[model samples]
Target: MINRIKSGIPGLDEFIQGGFPLPSVLLVLGEPGTGKTTFGMQSIFYAAKRGEKAIYMTGIAEPVFMIKKFMSSYKFFDESFIENGRVQFWDLGTSIQTMGPKKALDAITDIVRETKVTRVIIDPLPLAQLFSSPVDYRRYLYDFLAALRNLNVFTIIVGEKADESAADLEAYMVDAVIILYLKSLDNPLVYKNLMRIRKMRGTNHTRDVLSVEITENGMSVLKLD
Candidate 1:
């Protein structure tokens, strides 16, 4: 009996057997302009709207205010949802810079436990920058995910889809891998935004590429008609 956490992405849950499985970490890979942040934020905010405690943490070099301003333009960006503090945001770049990877990892797990957050989003997780060596990075990733599982939270780790193979460490480490692409569409296809689930450990998921849309309303997985 796997408890599923609803992502609130229309047409998406049906593809993944109701929703994302609980107590799992999902890696979302995407290139620039692929709406990775939008997808992560949309899911987190949607969960918050449904009375779930959610937090968005940026490991990248983005400022919180600027992110808020950009996300504010979205229709689902609710001040009410954010005001209750049930939905929160954090900048982990500062922590990584000051505390280094190990302490920063501890800080992350500490707050998540303290806040009792059920949903978490880590945007642009650059493992290379997080550690000095590949061995250290792999160890950190393993520990990071182990902590997440122990905490029993559903997490989404958003990252750049630079030239990488199926041998990518984080991709192999997570429970699922979802990739978003900014593709060109013509008569052969009707939409540009595309999505695919490369792997889902516990459920039967679609291998077929799906179409998506990102507007002021937020990201939505379009139904294949």
Candidate 2:
């Protein structure tokens, strides 16, 4: 039987047969305001609360202070986990910029193994692609995923939704692909946010476009049908 890792998002587990497959890499694609960061952070915080260690790594150079400030608004955000070392937040931007992809990968592997983290989030992974050519980027992803899988941790890679199709290297390389969309309604003045499980290997999952809401407490997925 394949093991599963709970995502910690309310109403999400039901769609994916209790949760994501264990030791799998998931690609989360979404537009700027579609709650990708919240999704990743919430999952980390949830696992941390349950006595599991997790890490949040951002490919961008944004300060951790700014991230905490924004996350503070969410009810699920817990500063204590960070303070107590149950959850770690690392910025990989400098490593990628200064040492390049090879060193950056080494840094990530070292950290995860040293910390014994069971869950990981690499937010805005598209930034890593900017540092390498398309061919090199694909190679980096292949190596990165293999390294993470070797650690037996559930990983989430967040990226902006590109104009490219699902066949895009990033989407195709991961074990699962989830797409979040913010679409304009008929009124034109309003928009509706939805999430879809584009592909999930080795597990049964709902493929329907489900409604998404970001409350003060965090995000919740509701089956539209």
Candidate 3:
């Protein structure tokens, strides 16, 4: 039996066959304002609550302070975890800009090894693309992911949507791909949040788009026929 790492997102685990496979990297693709950060942070916090060490690393997303500020309203946002060091946040934006992708990867590997983190979140991972060509970025990702796998941690990489016609290298590399979108109905005024599990290796997961809601607590996947 494959070990699984529960997502901790309400009603989402059921769809992914109890959660993601252990030590697997998952790609969370969505546009801005689609709650991508929220999903990542919530998962880290949830793991921390279970006495597991977790880290949240931001690429080009908002700073750690702003992320905490925004998540403060959520029920799952616990300050105690941060205070006790069960959960930590780091910004890789400066490293990626100043030291470059290779150095950034080294920094991440060092932190994860030093902290012995079992879960990690890299928000807005696509920001690395700005610092390198497509080929370079892919090579960097391959190396970075290999390092993480050796550490044996579950990782979530949050990124923006890729063109449908093009192959998303990140998605292809990861073990699972979850896409989030905000869409309007016929009226164009009634908007809804939706989530889809496009790919999940080694698991029989649902492939349909499901309605979702971002509430005071966190995101919840709705049950739809």
Candidate 4:
């Protein structure tokens, strides 16, 4: 039997063999407005509430204060968790820009080791443009995830929606891949948020496009079929 970590997203566990497996790397791909960051943060807070050390790192333009300002609207954003030191938020944009890729990755590794974090999130993982070459990025992604696995931590890497070609690499390289989609409906007031699981290692995950709901309470699945 394998130990699993709860995703913190309601109605998501039943499909992914209870939850995410320990020491696994999960890649989440979605469009700009799809809520990938929300999913990651919700999971981290969930794990933190259960006494696990969690870390959320953003390697993009968004500031931590801004993330908190927007996230404060969600029920999953708990003040006590941050106050008590169960979860830590970090910005790797500057590190990646100034110190370069190797040192940026090293900073992450060092923090995780020092804090003994169990759950990790790197929002908008700089894959293509950040690296000088596609080959280098691919190698870095593989080795980075492998290192996290060896440390026995569950990691979630969020990124923008990738094409079919890029998606193939994402599926092959990560232990699991989740794609979040936002479809426009006829009415301007309403839209549909759907979730699709591209691949999940060692688990028979659903292939159907699952209906999802993103509310003040955070994200949840509406219908399995």
TM-score of each: 0.94, 0.94, 0.93, 0.92
Model 2: per-residue lDDT, tens digit, 50-102? 99999999877366778889988999998899999999988887777887777
- Kindly indicate the candidate among 1 and 2 with the higher lDDT: 2
Model 3 residue runs over 4 Å out of place are 127-132, 162-166
Segments in model 1 whose C-alpha atoms lie over 4 Å from true places: 163-167, 187-191, 223-225
- Location of the lowest summed lDDT over 10 successive residues in candidate 4: 162-171
TM-score of candidate 4 against the unseen true structure: 0.92
- Whichever of 2 and 4 has more TM-score, that candidate is 2
Model 1: worst 10 consecutive residues (lDDT sum): 159-168
TM-score of candidate 1 versus the correct structure, residues matched by position: 0.94
Error of 1 at 50 (Å): 1.2
lDDT of 1 by residue, 144-184 (tens): 89999999999999877743464488888999899887666
lDDT of 4 by residue, 101-169 (tens): 867877788888888999999987775677788788788777777788888899998877643355666
Model 2 error, position 85 (Å): 0.5
Candidate 4: misplaced stretches above 4 Å?
162-165, 184-190
lDDT of 1: 0.85
User: Which pairs clash in the backbone of model 2?
Assistant: none
Q: How many residue pairs clash in each candidate?
A: 0, 0, 0, 0
Candidate 3, 1-225: lDDT as tens digits: 989999989999999889899889988887778888889988999999999999998876577788889899999999999999999988888788887778888899899999999999988774445644888778878988889988989999887774343236888888888888878856588988888888889999997788888999898896655
